[model samples]
Target chain A: MSDQEKEVTIYDIANKLNISAATVSRGLKDHPAINKNTKKKILAAAAEMGYRSNSFASNLRKKSSHIIGVIVPRLNSSFMSDVIAGIEKVVNEANYNLFISQSLESMKKEVSNAKAMFNNRVDGLMVSLAYDTSDIAHFESFINRGIPLVFFDRIYEHEKCPSIYINNYKAAYDITSHLIEQGCKRIAHISGNQLRNVYAERTRGYQQALKDNHVPFDDTLLIINDLSARAGNEAANQLLNLPVRPDGVFVANDICAISCMQAMKKQDIKIPDDIAFAGFNNDPTSCVIEPNLTTIDYKGYEMGETAARIMINHLVNNDDLQKTQSLILRSELIIRESSLKKGSKT
Target chain B: MSDQEKEVTIYDIANKLNISAATVSRGLKDHPAINKNTKKKILAAAAEMGYRSNSFASNLRKKSSHIIGVIVPRLNSSFMSDVIAGIEKVVNEANYNLFISQSLESMKKEVSNAKAMFNNRVDGLMVSLAYDTSDIAHFESFINRGIPLVFFDRIYEHEKCPSIYINNYKAAYDITSHLIEQGCKRIAHISGNQLRNVYAERTRGYQQALKDNHVPFDDTLLIINDLSARAGNEAANQLLNLPVRPDGVFVANDICAISCMQAMKKQDIKIPDDIAFAGFNNDPTSCVIEPNLTTIDYKGYEMGETAARIMINHLVNNDDLQKTQSLILRSELIIRESSLKKGSKT
Candidate 1:
């Protein structure tokens, strides 16, 4: 043979092995329909012949990049970090890369990020909506492209995109119900961006928990803000000045819980004595705080891994993603010192 | 001019405006040289004539996806989160997406992430070296392709790629010097992954401070490990058990410092009274920690903003990026109760 090179194609491999080109192509892509033994042989042969048909090249031919564009609310939060970690783990292993963008909690930035991702022509998308992201129209490009899409945490009520998240309402309900069982009649709630479904669901759970116990739910007890440490300090100050103070308090996050705890300590408001306290997202900061915060553990890492795994699994391994819908991960309520009014764990 | 079409080239703009095509191209790229007024006029005329040219498209044009891959050590840490946030912010603003992959603090994972990103056909790249990343050849693809690449904290040495970060050495030195000034005779130092420049720089700064202060630096005073909270607790135990205990402690990061403080508190080690302390990074936990932690305020949000700005500035503005090598932002020492030994502010 001459030194001139002839590029190896699936047809060449198929003809050499007396198999159909379609079967050879499927085997190259690691499709389960083709037996593993045959797939291995074809891959070895393709490698030997320097066959150039690979995932990226194949994706290009199909005009799709096997990439998922993800826009998050923010990057610095513990919960958000955990979620991204999970997503990175799964997506990396699946041979897909996560194009992560942060909105910095701005709806305008979120829209622009979506437009950029759309222009890049990603095969699919995963997103945790930004605070005050009301319009779903920015996501129409992905929907129009018929790309596989998944939303986690800060999700919307979009019918087109499937979502994966914990049952926030149920998780909150369980925590509130437990607080009621601890003989808390008058409860104070500190909530975050109520515009998002996560906080809204938790709020609903808090109200339902109060109503279920036949306690008159008072709107005056609800203190909503940015739910930052500063906000938590302010909330503590407001609670201390109330004419009828609450017997129990539920903070939406550990940062707020810790801040409130510090403020209460300064005011000599003993935890589990004057007011039983509970927080959400069992962040490590919860353990550092005095009396240790009791909280609902939202598994952000698990959420991220599940989202990436589901998105890539459908794109690469399975084809049932469009038919598959919502996935709800279970959340747990961890009981700790701050909420142990009846007596603590030894 | 024909109404059907009015042709314009870089030279046409250069000639019409009595400048070189190179100047015209630079102006179009938002170069520092081109005045804003001149750029606005050129862009207006170009838009009117249906001008379409991509700065990135002129590069080798490898039909690869316009994905700028990033490899961070871990996503959970506040510092890494800030750095990644900066990179993402900039990449998104430039209509380029970031394929974010974490090394999970292992060299093995870092290598794997690099492979995945490279295979993903990332057009350009950015990376913060992992705990033990000894290899640079792994980034050969981008380097060989003449693609713009940048590195930030936990960076590689003697590499030509542009880097964005604050001076870890100076920040560490300043904090150590502050502790020495506060009458700390025997100061214990908490270090991180010594293989990485960040922790190594901290150790060097600590020793340098001791030498500069006429205090004999002891090898026994240095504690090295992954600068996490768990590691800090272990270091705290070691320090507490010392025959001649240190009068002060300087932890490499805020999370570790807070954990060390809590551990010391459990042992009833009165902060600032018995042992003055300083931590790195002014995280929210630093403020929430009892007595408040005296720390080096490393702004994660600002770092992200700055990092993104530098990257986008280079990508969108000038191709003479070799002229722009590195950027180091300023950090300040925020004194609080933990390091207030001699009638200092709490």
Candidate 2:
């Protein structure tokens, strides 16, 4: 053997024990098919030879560092925090350490973060794409090295790269339909960058809902921005200045929707009477906002837990690798005071 | 000279050149006092001998992995997230990777996290103590190993471990005094576990302020809980059940104070007219809550930036390690409608 401590492979143990490499591998996992005597002999030989394997190995094998890298767009949001909390709970219980970083909604930071995670030699990786992340080539290194990658929330659907997300299209459709049932004749949409799958699907759902309801779809009714509070305020300004005002507004998220509602209220617009409102992600703010926001309830914590469990199961079993290819969690529309326009729910 | 690649020390390179180890260390950092010729010779010999150093050193020196481990109480809070964002910004610019973990407010989790970080061989460590973490013996390993550790926010002021935090005592005093100035004779204080220095100091400030104002200190007015929203609601219930309701409340944090205020509103209690409220950590919700919350504006981002800068400077300069033994960031009271009973600021 070379003097360099370049990773110990099963071949080294096989040569030492005068057994097949397959036999050494089987012995490492303590396979029942292998005879006890042979397994014991192979395990001793493997230990003597300093054999190391990433997964399914005996005490002789080098143990993993048990580090999981998490990459998200930002950490400031309650939804992202809850997702992280869920992941941390499961991972910490499994005796794994989680290293979290944010992309700050930039592809440059995302690429750099992926590179850093790779260099750190994290056992596995979980990613939630940034708002502007269009290229996923950076993840190819992990895939090539056989390191597992799982994505939650803002995910990309690449083969072998498992992704967990909610049914955004259905959620959006339900929210829009609910607003329509509230007697909103002219409804407007506040969305984010169309590049992201979440926003795109939501837009599609909104359009589909309008078409099904026989409401003329005016391109001017859709406003696309970063969905920041400032953007929401500006959207309210634009709506107020429009020739025909929208009686209802369906926004991408709660914070922005609340900001827009606040701006409209400042202009003496009565909520549910002058302009109904709806948003996604039932954030805490949604509950506190005056005439509470109508929104879609996406269980971020459950999604995070599910994503983490899938990754851990893949890491441990390695047999159900294909089962986690894609998953869609359930979402529900929460009708609140913001959209109860025609009459109070009571 | 040894077969084991147990670090190529400065002594090894110094012995090769028949010079003092101190000279080799000085030359490696490009000390200007060292003669250029001797420095050049030392560099060449160091490169040939495979002598390595930290990240700032040249390529010939085996570069450090440049990974920083950060342990926080939890990740769900906006304040913590902002601080992390600031740390990430500075560290990424310095070409370092951040690995973050949460203790879930448990000392056991914090200890395990510290051990994991130590095993991962992080170049530096930043920690925010968990709610119940009293004994910091877990960090002794890092100190014994001479690895740098910086504590931020929920910090511990050890011998050499520098801590960055706001003046919790002063901030709490200001909030309490403001309530008193607003004609609130009986002011209640809502705080977290007293084990944490942040909460303990804030509680002390609350008591000091009440004493200075000539108000009788009532033990019943001090409600200590986990400070969660649920806790805040329960505290409100307890207050409502009191024979004489406290006219003012000063919560250790904004989220809890907001929750308590919302619960009071639910009971048809008029804000400011019946009860004035103040809180710490001017969280975003502080601005959005009806009758904007009066809070202490603690700059989480700046604190994080300062902490990262201090850590990076320590790593790069390797001088004045003692100067950063502790740091106190500036905090100010933001008077909003929540606590303003006399008249509007306008």
* C-alpha lDDT of all candidate models, in order: 0.79, 0.84
lDDT of 1 by residue, B62-139 (tens): 454556777888898867787677667766767766788888878888777776765565656777888877777767
Root-mean-square deviation per candidate? 10.0, 11.0
Estimated TM-score for each candidate: 0.80, 0.82
Docking class of 2: incorrect
What's candidate 1's DockQ score? Answer: 0.24
Model 1 docking category: acceptable
Task: At residue B251, give the lDDT of candidate 2.
Answer: 94
- Over the stretch A282-302, how does candidate 2's per-residue lDDT look in tens digits? 998898888889999998888
lDDT of 1 at A122: 70
What TM-score number comes out for model 1? 0.80
The most accurate candidate by DockQ is: 1
Error of 1 at B245 (Å): 2.2
Over B1-346, each residue of candidate 2 has an lDDT whose tens digit, in order, gives: 2343234578988899999999989998999988999999998886555454533223113324377888988877889878887887888788777777889899998998887776556678999999999888888767655678899988888887899998899999888998988899989899999989999999999999989999889989999999999999999999988989999999999889999999999999888889999989998888888989999999888988999998888877775657877899999999999898956444
TM-score of chain B of each: 0.79, 0.82
Model 1 lDDT tens row, A213-247: 89888888998888888898999999989999998
TM-score of chain B alone in model 2: 0.82
Best by lDDT: 2
